[model samples]
Target: MEILNSKEMIYSPTENREEKLSITGRVTFLSMVAGSVLALTNFISNSALAEDVIKIGTPLALTGGLADEGKKQQIAYDMWLRRVNAAGGINVGGKKMKVKLVAYDYQTDGKRAGQLTEKLITSDKVHFLAAPFGSGHTKITAGVAERHGVPIVASTASSLSVYNQGFKNIFGTLAPNTGMTEAMMKFFKKKLPGTQKVAVLGRDDVFPRAMAKSLSKGARNRGFDVVYDELYAVGTLDHASSLSKIKSEKPDWIYLTGYTQDLILLRKQMSDLGVTAPIVTMVTGPAYKEFVDGLGKLADGVTSSSWWHHATDYKSDDVFGSTKAFYTQFVKEQGHDPDYVHASAAAALIVLQKGIEKAGTLNRAKVRDAIASLDIVTFFGPIKFSPNGMNQVRDLPIIQVQKGKVSVLHPADIKNAEMQKM
Candidate 1:
C-alpha cells in the first residue's frame, strides 16, 4: 500500500522486495569504498525491515472536497506517531513496538475508500484500521472492516445511524450527534428563554442531516416552535432560496450543520440575503479559526458547539499528559490553533494505542475488547465506549465567535466569556 503521509517519522512497508532496493545503477566496490558500501547496505536493510511494528491503515480523501479535513487527520496521526516513537513506541507483551501508518488516498470516492479499507486488511495485513473522514464514508469503511474482523476507529463519524448498525469491529471517538445537539438546545433555551421560534438548515448528507434531525427533536422538547427545517443538496453554491424561506418564517434562532466549506458559503449567503436571527448557531463551522478569519465582521456572534476544544482542562495518562500540553505542542509544531477535528483524530489514535497496550498483544479481538471496556480520560476528554462502540462523553463545549475571538460561553466552569447577542 502507498503511504500518503509518511513524513520520515511514519513507516511504509512494501509487499514487493524489489521496491526496497536502495543502491541503484552500477556500483563498483574498491578497497577504500568497501567499508562505506557495507555501512550503507546495513542502513538500508534495517530501514526496509518492518518487524516488531504496529501498522494501522487509513483511507483519506486527500484530493477532493474533504481534503482540508483529511489533512487535519494526517497531522494528528503524525503527531501521535512522533510522540509514540519518541517514547520508544507502544508496549506490547513486554516489547516496545514501533508504529507504521499506511494511508491511501481515496480521492473522496466512497466506493474507492471501502476498497482501500479491505485491501488494507487482507492484502496489507494491517493490524488495525482508521475509518475515513465523515460518517458517510466511515460507514462504508466500517462495514468492510467488520466483514474482515479487523478493529477500526472512526475519528469524525458521529451520526447515531452509523453506530446503530450491528457491527462488532467499529468504534468512534466522537459521541453521537445527539450529544452536541442536546447540549446546544439546553444552552440556548436557558440563555434566551424567549426564543420560541427556531429554524434549522443543513447539508443533505449523512452527518449533517442526522444532526439536524437530532437538533429539531431537542428544540421541540425545549418548547420551541419549529418554524422552518430544510436540507440543502450537497455542493450547493446558492443558498439564497433557502435563506429567503427562513427569513419569511421570522425565527428567533437559526441552527445550521455542515462541513467547513459548505457552512462558509452558506454564511455569506445569509449575509447577502439579509437573513437575521438573534442567535445564529452553526454546529461545526466556528470550531475552526478559518471561519472567523474568513468573514471578518460577519462571523461575530456566530456560536457553535464541539465535542472537544483546546480550552478544555483535563489530565490524561497518555503521551501529551494534559489538554494544555497537547495544545501547546500542537500550536508550536503546526504554527496554528488546532480545531475539534484535530483533537478528535488524535483521540482516535490514542484509543488504539491504549487498547493495544492494555491487551498486551496484537490480537484483534482482544484489542477490540480492551477498547470497548475502556473508561479513561485523555487530552480530548473522557472516552468510554458504549456497547455499540460510540463514545459516551457528553461534556461538549458551547462556543461563540465574538469580535473574531472564539470563546466558550456555556458549562460555567470553562466559560471564558458570555454569549454575545446580536
Candidate 2:
C-alpha cells in the first residue's frame, strides 16, 4: 500500500499492519490534513489584515536653518503617535488600524520639500500628509499635495499667501499673518495711547515680508504713522545699515518679523547700535524659549503673538484631555515645556485624526470634506477652517516676555499678565 505525504509517497508492506492505516482511518487522516490547510490559510489572511496601517508622510527641515522648529514638529507628532497607539490605535470603519509616519529631512530647501512630498504620495503611497515647517516649505509641498488631491494639515504656516492659491486640499493650523498682528495693534491703541510712530522690518521671505506688510497696514489703520518699512535680505548678518536708518527715524514702535535666528541677531544688533524703541514687537521669535535663552534679559518686554499656549485653560474632549493636560504630557515626554509651535504642530495632527474618525472611511474626498466642516475646539484652541482652508476659530494670543517668562498680553479674557515696558 502507498501512503501520500507532503513531499513524497512511500510504499509499506501489509505485514506492518500496526503502522499502516486502514481505508477508513486513511479517510479520517485526510480530513484532518484538509482542516489543517484551511486553518493555515485563514491564519495567513488574518495576519495580512492585522498588519494594515495608516501611513502619514512628512518632510521636515531636520538639518538646516529651520531644524529647531522642524524637530519640535516631529516631537509633537511623536507625542500624538504614542497616545493613539497606546489606546489601541485609531478606530477606522469598526477596525482598529495603527499609524506609521514616513518622514524625510528636506534640509530646509523648498524645492526639495516639494519633491519629497510628491515621492511620498506616489512611491510610498501614504494615506495622508503633514506640511513641512515654515510658509515657504509648506507652500511648496502643499502644491504637490493639492495636485495629487491629498489632504495636508499645515502646522507652522501662517502666511495668507499660501492659502490664497485656491488649493482645496490644504488646511492650516495657524491663523493668517494679518490676523496675528491685529490683536497687538488694537492693544497698543487702547493701552498705549501715545504710541504713534512705527517702523516695520522683516526678512526678504514670503512669510516675514507678508507679516511686515500686514503689520504696517494694521498699524497705519490704527492711527500710527509708518516711519520706516523695509525688508532686509535673507541671511543678512549685519543690519547696521538698516538699524542706522531706523535709529534716525526714532520710531516709537518697531515691528521685526523674521525667523528665530534672524530675529535673535537683529535684537543683538539693535542693542549694539543703541537703537531703542519704546514698544518692540517681534512676529514669532519672542514666543519661543530659544529666543529668551539666546538673549536672557534682553528678551524682556519683547512682545510676540502665537496660535496656542500651554497656559490656556481651554477644555477639549480629544485625546489630550485639556490645554493644561496637553502641556503636562508634553513636558513629561519631551522633558520641557511646549511652545505655540509645538502646540500648533500637535493640533494639526489632532485635527487630521478627528477628521478621519468623523468620516469613518479612508476615502480622501470624504476626509477632506470632514476637515473643512470641522468646528471643534481642541487643546490648541477653537479650530474652524474658512472656505480658504485656513483656521478661523482661534485668534492669536499676544505674548510678551517678562522676567524670563512668557506672559499673555492681549485678549484680556485669557491674559496671564499685563505687558511691561521695555
Candidate 3:
C-alpha cells in the first residue's frame, strides 16, 4: 500500500465510544476530496480567465490593391488598441477586462475578406468585429455577424448601400456618398464662382459609382453643365482613354472619385496630357502625403473633400485633442500621418469605448443597446446615432493641398486656410 501525506488524512465525526476512524482509511478519503476540490478550483479559475479576454477581430487588406487604405485603418486601429490598453483596458460592470485585438490581412480580395471574417467568428470566436476597406468586404461580414449575433462597426464603408441592407448588426463610420455629393457641390458653389462644364470620373464600385451619380445629379440640378462623366474599374491602371474623352468634351472642371492608385495614375495622366482646366477637384482620400508622394508635383494644387482635417483648431471640436494625439503617436510609430481611413477608424473606436463605458456591462446585448442609444460627444463632433446607426454629423471637410501640405478650406468654423486651385 502507498503511504499518504498529512493533507490526505482527516478525522470523521463519530459517537462510537471505543475508537475513531483509521488514519489510512482517512488518508484515502481525504485524498479523493482534496483532488476533487483542486479540480473544481482550477475549473473556476479558467472560467474567470476566459471571461477576462474580450476578442476583437478585423479583416483588412493590408496588402494588394486596397493596400493603402487598409494600411491606414490598421495604423489607426493599433493606436486605438494602444490607447485603450494604456488606460487600463475597458471597465466592464466595475471590473477591468483587457482587450485582445485579432487582425488578419485579406490582401484586398473580397472572397478572402469574407473567409477571414467567418474564420474569426466561428473558429477564433471573437467577441466583436470591425469593418474593412470596401463595401463588398463589409457586406460579407455583415451577414456573418448577423447570423452569429455579433455586432459590427464598419471602419471604412462609406457607401449608402450599407445602410440600405437593413442589417441590424452592422454600422458604418462614414457618411453616405449621397450626402457628400450635395456637400461638395455646395462648397464648390460657395468657393469657386463661374464653375461650369463639370466632368466627373469614378471607379465602377459601390462607393465611387454612388458618389458619381449624386455628383452628376447635383451638378445638373445646380446648372453646372455635366459635360462628361465616366466610370472605370476600381484598379484600372490606364486613365489615358478617359482623359482623352474628357479633354474632347472641353469641360472647365474635372471631378474625380476613386481610391489611391486610380487617383494617382489619373492625376499623372492629366498632367502628361496637359489637360489643365484650372478647376480640378477630387472627393477625398487622396490629400494625404502618400498620394502627394505617389504623384510628385502632379499632386500639386489638387483639392479633395474629407471628413477630418488635423489643421482645424476648433475649441468645441471633440476630435481635436484626440486627433492631434493620434497623429503624434502615429508619426512616431508608423513614420507618417494617419489618413482619413485611419482617422475614421480611430474615431469609431472612441465612440464604441464611450458606449461601453456608459453601459457598464460586458453583456453583448446590453452593449449593442447602449451603442444604439448613445448620444455622446466624441473627438469628431457630437456623436449621436440615427435610426439607422449613422452619425448625425455628416458634414465633410474640403481640403486643398498647398506646397505638399493639406489644409482645411471649407466650413468656416473649421476652415484654417484659403482654397487654392490645382
Candidate 4:
C-alpha cells in the first residue's frame, strides 16, 4: 500500500508574486491575523502556523517484522486526515484549520524510533505525536515525547507496564493486557465446565510476558489449575521443545501470546508435534485476516481477544459515523475487513482531535488535560482514559474463527456466535 503524504507546505508571498492562493487557504490564513502583512510574515516565518494547520508527527515501521501492522496504521491515519480535510478541517477556538501529518518510516528499530521521535519534536516541530507500532517501540519513543512535553497518542501499546511509567503526556487507545484474558476466562468457565487445566506460553517481551502473567492470574482466580507456564526468548522460532513438554501435561486449554509471526509459527509447530488441546487461545493473530490466510483450516476454532470490532452498536461524531460505517468504508478502501489494530489506530487520532477541540487552543497542557478527562463514545468503543492515561472504558471482546470467519463469542450484547470446541 502506498502511504499518502498529508503534509502541506505553505510558501511565502515573496516566492510567487503573481500566483493566487486557494479560497480555502486564503480564508483560513486571513482569519488568523488582522492585516495581510502580518499574515504573510507569520506564514513565511512559521510554516506550521497554528491558524492554518495542526501538524502531527508519526513514526511508522515500514520495514522488518512489524511492516504490515505499520502499513495498516498508516492507512487509518490517512483515512482520518482525508475525512477531516474534506470537512474543512478541525474547529479550534472558532477557527478552522487543516490537519497535516509529518510521518517517517522507522524501519522497525527501537533505537531509530527514539532518534526519529526527537527529530519529529525538535526539528519537524509537530504539535502532537503518534506512537510507533508495538509496546517496546512505543515505550522508547514515548519517553522522548514526555521529556519534550509533547502529547502523544499510542495506537497499539496495550501492556499495563507501558503506562505505569510516570509520564503525563502519553495516552493509549487499547485497554490493558489483563482485559484480554479476563474476558476469555469468564466465557470459558461458563461454556466449558470441565476445563480446568491450562498451559500458558508467551515470548519473553514486554507485552507478551505481561499478558501471560495476567492470564495466569485470571485463570487461577477462576479455579482453573495452571499446569505449565513459561516464557521463551524473542526470536526463538523453533518451539518443538516447548510443545513436547506441554504435550506431556495434557492441558485442556493452551494459551499463547506473541507477535503475529511468532503465533503463526507456534500454531504450525503445535500441529507438527501432534499436540491437540480442546481449547486454544492466541492473542491478536486470529483477529487479523492474515492469520486465516496463512493457516487456512488451522485457524478454525482458534479464539482471540480484541479491543474493538464492527459488530458493536457504538456511534461517534467523527468522520466515520458509526461502527458499521467505519467497517464498510475500511473494507471498501482496503479490500479486506479491518481488525482491532486498524480501528485502534484511527481512534487514537480521533481522541487527539477531540481533545484539541475541547481545549479550544493548541496549548499542550490544556490539550493534555482534555484528553485525560475525555469520556466520549467512539466507533472503536467507549474511549475514556484513566488517570494513568490508559483506556478504561472498553472491555476486550472474545472472538473465535468459525467456518473461516471471525465470530464474536462473548459479551452477550454483541456476540454473533457461541463458543465452539477445537
At residue 333, what lDDT does model 2 achieve?
Answer: 75
Query: For candidate 2, lDDT tens digit of each residue in 1-422?
Result: 11122122111222133234335877557655654555566456645753577778898888777888888898888888888888887778787788777787888788888888888798667789999888888889999999999999999888888899999999998888788788778887777888889999998999889999989888878778999999999879888899899999998898999888898988999999998887898878877888899988888889998877777788997778899999988888778889987898889989998898888888889999999999988999989999999998445788999998889876777889977777
lDDT of 4 by residue, 16-83 (tens): 33233334667546533333565467566665465588889888998877899898899999988988
> Which pairs clash in model 1?
none
The regions of model 4 sitting more than 4 angstroms off are: 1-50
**TM-score computed on alpha carbons, candidate 2:** 0.87
What local lDDT does model 3 show for residue 111? 82
| Model 1 lDDT, full chain set | 0.85
Please give, for residues 160-258, the per-residue lDDT of candidate 1 as tens digits. Answer: 888889998899999887988888888888888888999999899898899888888888887789998889898788888889999999999999988
Say which prediction, candidate 1 or candidate 3, comes out ahead on TM-score: 1
Off by over 4 Å in 3: 1-47, 313-321
For each candidate, what TM-score against the reference? Answer: 0.89, 0.87, 0.83, 0.89
* lDDT, residue 416, candidate 3: 79
Return model 1's CA RMSD, one decimal. Answer: 4.9
The digit string of per-residue lDDT tens for model 3 on 225-269 reads 998888988568798988998998888679988876678878888
For all candidates in order, the CA lDDT equals 0.85, 0.83, 0.72, 0.85
- Those runs of model 1 whose alpha carbons end farther than 4 Å from true positions after fitting are 1-51
* Residue 209 accuracy (lDDT) in model 2: 96
